[model samples]
Structures are given as structure tokens and as C-alpha cells.
Target: MKKRTMRWASAGLVLSLFLASLSFVPSGSGNASAATSKSMAALYAQIQNERAAKVVALVNKERAAAGLKPLTVHTNLSKMAKDKAIDMFKNKYFSHTSPLYGSPFDMMDAYNITYRYAGENIAKGQKSAEEVVEDWMNSPGHKANMMNANYNLIGVGYYNGYWVQEFIGK
Candidate 1:
């Protein structure tokens, strides 16, 4: 009970911090409510532009020395991002009869997570799985997760367009 309570408290604190760090546009300010169509890469570029200026500078500095192209990366968004994503898969997504037992998730080292799924079912009235992932990746929880993992890269790999879902950490 004590352990569980502590975990809950920590989660709450981290979640609070994550929310506090979020930058929001005021209501009806700068097309905040309007739906502007943008491709995934465009949206990602925008997020990188706004959220990762420091990363951009560092990457440029290093790449200039190495004569390599600069890179933009995504880090975890919140403290609970990975945990919540894993739990969502274990409790809500994966099939109960899966051979992997309780969760088809593997923490592939301190920073990476991989999941093998026969299939996944999103909760009733919830967004599709892709949307869920996108939201989670962009949430405050992702940063928390990244910090905990001591990772600097945010990447997702789908093998053969099925079976394997690998979350990358660098």
C-alpha cells in the first residue's frame, strides 16, 4: 500500500509539472481553434521549431564539426508517457489471449520500448490508435518519460507494416 501510494503521489507531481510546462495560445488567438490542414511532417516540424530550439542549436553545433546534416528529434513529452502508453496497450489494446501474457511490451534497455501485437482495439468512444499515439507523444507525459529514460530521440518504427512496434530512444 505504501509503495502504491508513493507511486501515485509521484505520478501526480510529475503530471502537475508537465502541465505547468505546456505553452498555450490564448483562446481564439492565432488560429488556435481553427483547423489548419498540415501534413504529419509539417506538424512535426512545427513542434520541433517551437519546442526544441535548444536541441536544434546543439545538433547544428555537433553536425558542423562532424560535417553531417543536422537533425531534429523528439524527446519524451511527459514523465508518465511511456508508462501510460504501455498500460494502455496492456490493459486496453492487446488481446487477452496473447502469448506474451500480461503485457506484450518489452523495455528494450533503459530508453526504448517495444510491443508485439496481434492486433489492438481502441476503447469505445476513444480516438483511433494512431491518434492516441500522436496525442501521447505530444503530451507532457512524453517529456517526463524521456527524462526518466535519459533518452534524446523520439522515434517509432513499424516493421513490415505490422506485428512490431518499436519506440526508439537515443
Candidate 2:
């Protein structure tokens, strides 16, 4: 009971810090909204501009470097993203699911970004999953802040040559 309480307390503290960080955005200012839109547009453009064939080749090259089997590059961006997410989870590298598993919208909200289905609005062309991921990782604002603050807990305890998720086992 005490351990559970401590865990909940820590979670609440982290959440409070996360919310407080948002207060840096001026009240009733449109810049926050506009900045988000611009970031999303950049992401959309990056995804659209990336060639699926080139992305596939890049992924295959990366796999060879990692000594893993190459994935078949498909011209389907959505499918590629899904497969990459699964593969990353399998590798225990990084996981969107690990942070928040409820829904995509919720996850996007936590990350403070807009997410749209490929056919919904801006993203129409198919890009390789790896390319899309690279774009997101390279994004300036939300991605950086999230890594620095909210998700840092998951990253800690893994440093200093220790397995943080030891309870889950290797």
C-alpha cells in the first residue's frame, strides 16, 4: 500500500510539473496555437516530401548496421509506421505504447501535438515509416520538451548500467 501510494504521488508530481511547464505559454495568446500549427505543418511536409522507396532503402541499411533482418519497404506510410512501432517495441528501444497506451489522440495530447490520419488532411503521399519517425524525432518543440520532462522518468534508472524495468524482466 505504501509503495503504491508513493508511486501515485510521484506520478502526480510529474504531472504537475508537466502542466506547470505549459503555463509558460502566455494566457489568451494565439502564438501557442499558431506555433503548434506550424510545427504540424512542417511534420506533414516532411512526411509528404520523403520518398517511400528511399525510406525503405534507408531502413534496410539501418537494419544491416544493426544486424537485423530488413523489412520490406511498402509505399504505404500508415502501414510502415505501425510496423515500425511494433518493431521498436520488440527491440525494447522506445515505445509510444510504453508512455501512454490508451488512445492515439490521448498520446498526441500528452505530446502536445496534432495527429491526423494519413488521408484526413495534409499527409496524402505515402512515406516510409522510418522516415516519418525520423521527422518526428527531429522535431524541435514538443519532442524535445517531452524527452526532457514527461518521459524522462522512463529514461532514468536505466542509466548507470541498470535495467529500470527489471520487474518486468529481461
Candidate 3:
């Protein structure tokens, strides 16, 4: 009889533990999912921002080697570049001229970025900041934009697999 009672008690304890585990399990409801999504988006944006900053530093190092002044990051231009990067990623297009924003100049104008000279470089599918910068350095046109002594301001944006670098002189 004592063994029988012990077996029943153990079964009850196991059942209680199972029930308690269910309460700890995620419900996968709309609210919890939405919160998770929001946090993930914010974290992704932060990572992209860090990548963009690295691009700026690498570009500056190249400019320094070329005896050119380091370009300062402009907040307005950064915002514009980020918008362009996101737009290209979402719209599945890649170019200096965007379907939504026409040209880089048009994007700057839309963003109210004043500049005497402006240039933009866009790339897709490059894995890291160094790889993208190296690719741009190897290209004649992109190298021109990066090496141009006239440009004193820069904005870099990276999102998913897209990158945009905006150069401005004022």
C-alpha cells in the first residue's frame, strides 16, 4: 500500500511539473511576437549603423593615404543615404539613380542637404565594409568619388546587402 501511494504521489508531482512548464512556454501570441519583431528591427538597425561607421573610417583612411582631408559625416546626408539603402533593399533595385528618388542629387534635395558638389556610390551583396570599400577602390568611378579632394563630407549607409555612400562638398 505504501509503494502504491508513493507511485501516485510521484505521478502527481510529474503532472504538476508538466503543468508548470507549460506556463513558462511562450504563447506565441500577437503581442509577444510584435514586441520581439520590434526589438529585432532596432538591433538590426544598430548593426547597420555600426557597419556604416566602419565604412566611413575605412574611407577616411584611404583619403588620408591619398593626402586628402578626411570627410566629415553629415547627419542629413547619413539620413538620406540610409533611406536610399533601405529603399533599394525593399524595392529590389540597385543604382545611383533610384526608382523612388530619381538620382542621388534628387535624394539630397529631398532631404534638404545643401552641397556645392555631390556624388554617390552604391553597391549590393558585398559581405563586409572592407570588402565593399575594396571593391569600390578597384572600380575607376567609385575610386574617383572616394579619392576626390573636393568632397569634404560623407555619409555611409548599409542595410542587409545594400550599401550607399554619399559624398558632398560645400
The global Cα lDDT (0 to 1) of model 3 is: 0.92
Total backbone collisions for each predicted model: 14, 0, 0
What lDDT would each prediction earn against the true structure? 0.37, 0.37, 0.92
Model 1 lDDT per residue over 1-170, tens place: 99999999999999998876654556765643243434555685554333334333433454446554443343432222233334445565433233333332323323343323211211222223343334433555432332323333333221111112222333
Expressed as tens digits, the lDDT of each residue in 1-170 for candidate 2 is 99999999999999999998875777677678678989988885454334433444543454456555544322233333343344344554553333433333343344443323211101112244343435533655422322221121111011111111100000
Give the winner by lDDT: 3
Off by over 4 Å in 2: 27-29, 50-170
Q: What is the lDDT of residue 61 in candidate 1?
A: 53
